[model samples]
Target: MEALLILGGAVVFLCAWVWLAVTSRRLPVGLFVVALALPMLTLLLRRKGYSRPARLLLLTGILISAAGVALLYREQPEQFDQLISGSWVTQPSDSALSGTLMQQPFVPNDVRWQGKHLIFAEKAGERIRRSLVVKFDRAEALLQGTAIDLLPGDTGPWPELVLQWYTGALEQPGLRRLDGGYSMSLALAAQGPGQTEMVVHLHLPSEFGTRLTGVVVIDGQPQWLGKSAAVPEPRPAPEPAPAPEPSRTWQEVSILALLDEPQMYVGQAVRLTTTSGKEFAGTLTAVTDDKRVVLALPQGANQVDFQFHPVDIQRLQARPRQ
Candidate 1:
């Protein structure tokens, strides 16, 4: 989104520059674009010169030009934070939602332009260790209601029921996950915890399968949701690192911003990457006058080596935690 904004600004600046070159000396670049594009567009006016329709169209363009500039300089207000947190998920004696989304009243699966990450409600405690998807915003949400987690098994002897959940049937409230347990074709269950449920059909890797059954909560509202997932056991706590003293700490910038810098001094180390496929750690090795960057191999780096790419790369992040 920011990239698009920068690009649009550059295009406008370019038109202003070109207009300044061709127009009369008295007008500023801004005024030139506002005025020049007008006469240039006169050819589009089919009516004869000084005609009523021609004057109306020209006046209309001037009005639109003023409106456009007003919009360009306008600072829009911050967005409403629709992100849900806390008991919205876990405490549901009055409700069972522990995560976002379900914590809020279901308002018809709405339009969310900013977006979310992780099926928080479904994932609960799962960690996305070393992932390849790049997303700067780690906003999470959960689709809670009911779901069926399916697991695989062999032949009639075949597999884990946890690998299977009947959700296709819940989509329209008429679909089903067949109980006979073997057909590729699914069947609907006359059963449900509500008039509608958010069904998740888990297709496990072809090899491993585990035990499956109704996901029952020991404490909170014992929701008889379709399926359950094995909450991943938390890892043993690692030794904590010393927090940086404020005096020694440095401000951080996004990799995108670092790329916009006209130059990088030697030994200028910066952090990049985020939960998304962004670069979390890297050093700026070189920079060009055009505001493009060259990232160096990271300190003690043992993974993929940095390579040359002619196009502008947006992967390296330099955002520092405050």
Candidate 2:
């Protein structure tokens, strides 16, 4: 019985897609219905005792259907807007106050356009206050948001300007605040004097519903934008600084040199090997001007001090830091 339901749901989903492709008139509506239904179908299939091959086929179908819907929305956003509201027809408006700032489903409640500046505002809720602004001068492009500011020196071409802005923004402190806990991207669609076209892409969390939202702006005016694409993955954080190089104090030196510069080895761990094959490890205590030395060695319970002539020290080694 469960297998039958699983098979039935898959058939219905495919039939819906076929109906959409064949008619081409109600594509968005059919795609939306299928997108919503495909998951439920997959869920039912998983609960059933279906064979592995059968379950895999159903899951693959869900992924393909979802990808197709995403592609359609990306390539033909205007058409997708038709299904947003029965009364809300998709149309372009010159004034930001009246026309839709973005496509349906993501239509901002408020949009303000001033000379060289554009502001977008969404309906305020209890937890989130969403807004964005873009300003441009002949010498610089400024993007100020709720949490971060992208200040890039005037570089010709919008793409390069955006790229530069992105690079600099990463270095700015408190980037997570600007992102509002979501992934975002800025792209240059076109550019001109007194007018610049761009897109603000947002990949919100799954709880926010749509993962991608593209806001298209032209000449400081929003043309059309919507939440429709996958958010660009964030780059990895930088690697940590390499550890400091170890100190090199094991170099060979003459016993007379040690006597002359005993201050250099004071308080340092030193190992002295004599010509007779005896080794002594201790802290250098003192060196007399007459070429005499004092070594404090650690015995079982107490430290033993030894006095020796500089010539008795055949080899000296200084231990590095722990």
Candidate 3:
């Protein structure tokens, strides 16, 4: 069904292009129409089992279309941008604000304006930093009110902007570094009066790609924001830590526990190395109450019993199960 729809759309597009080429008498449009139609015709021919001719036509069409599209995009960049790009305008409601938040790719999740307060939010996750742009219709009114608060996730009350502005410079009072990202806020109250247009730039915290769900509450009503909207900066790759060396010592209680399980350890191949650089490999025989261990060492057809103090042994490990 989808393929048929695509085919039908392509056919309509080609027919329109053909009509434009014929009526306007433009050489470029005619060439572009030919380029666009060739691939479709080649596909139809291939589907009909005309393999050899289809392949030849497909190759030729692809090359022509590629060159034409590239030239068209370069010559008329604005047209290409219009075709490929889009813009999102948030619908205004009693609980939400009425304004254009961002152009297509940088669109926010939600925006609201209540009285003199303007609030907008975008989605962000852990370790990622995304930018959000907020435009105020009445900047002068907001600048005369309270501070602008920027809160990332639940950790807030951060005062991003204070009640002072000097030569377009803002006085950030509660700007601090957070564990996941930066803790900051923004306030337009410091801006000079009579300013009609105001744009606020904000960088939300990173939460390791986990969506930081929060709201930008303005005036009193909470406006929900941040739903996979913010585009975060690429974090640097983490450095791997070095592996730790294994310990050689054993606890006294652990050694005693092994002795209690004589039935499991007895006749099993065991290896013990001492701090004095002596090593022994044999089958475990007996464990004495005096903190000593006995091993039956293989000696030709005979077995020799070896005894050693547990305190002197530095490392002991069991061999592979036989």
Mark the 10 consecutive residues where model 1 has the least summed lDDT.
Answer: 127-136
- Model 3 Cα lDDT, one tens digit per residue, 208-289: 2111122222333322221122434433323224234333222122455666675666766677664334455677888867
lDDT of 1 at 170: 20
TM-score: model 1 vs. ground truth: 0.19
Ranking by lDDT: 2, 3, 1
lDDT of 1 by residue, 1-322 (tens): 3234444544554454344335434555554354455544433444323234433444454455545444433321111011122423443242222211212221111111112211212221231111111111321111122321111221132221211111221232111222223211111232344222222122222232311111122222213323334444433323225456653343554455444542543245544332212233345566655443455543343432232222223234232333
Report lDDT (CA) for all predictions.
0.30, 0.43, 0.39
Instruction: Give TM-scores for every candidate, taking all chains together and pairing residue i with residue i.
Output: 0.19, 0.23, 0.22
Q: Among all windows of ten consecutive residues in candidate 2, which has the lowest summed lDDT?
A: 160-169
Candidate 1 global CA lDDT score: 0.30
Instruction: Give the clash count for model 3.
Output: 16
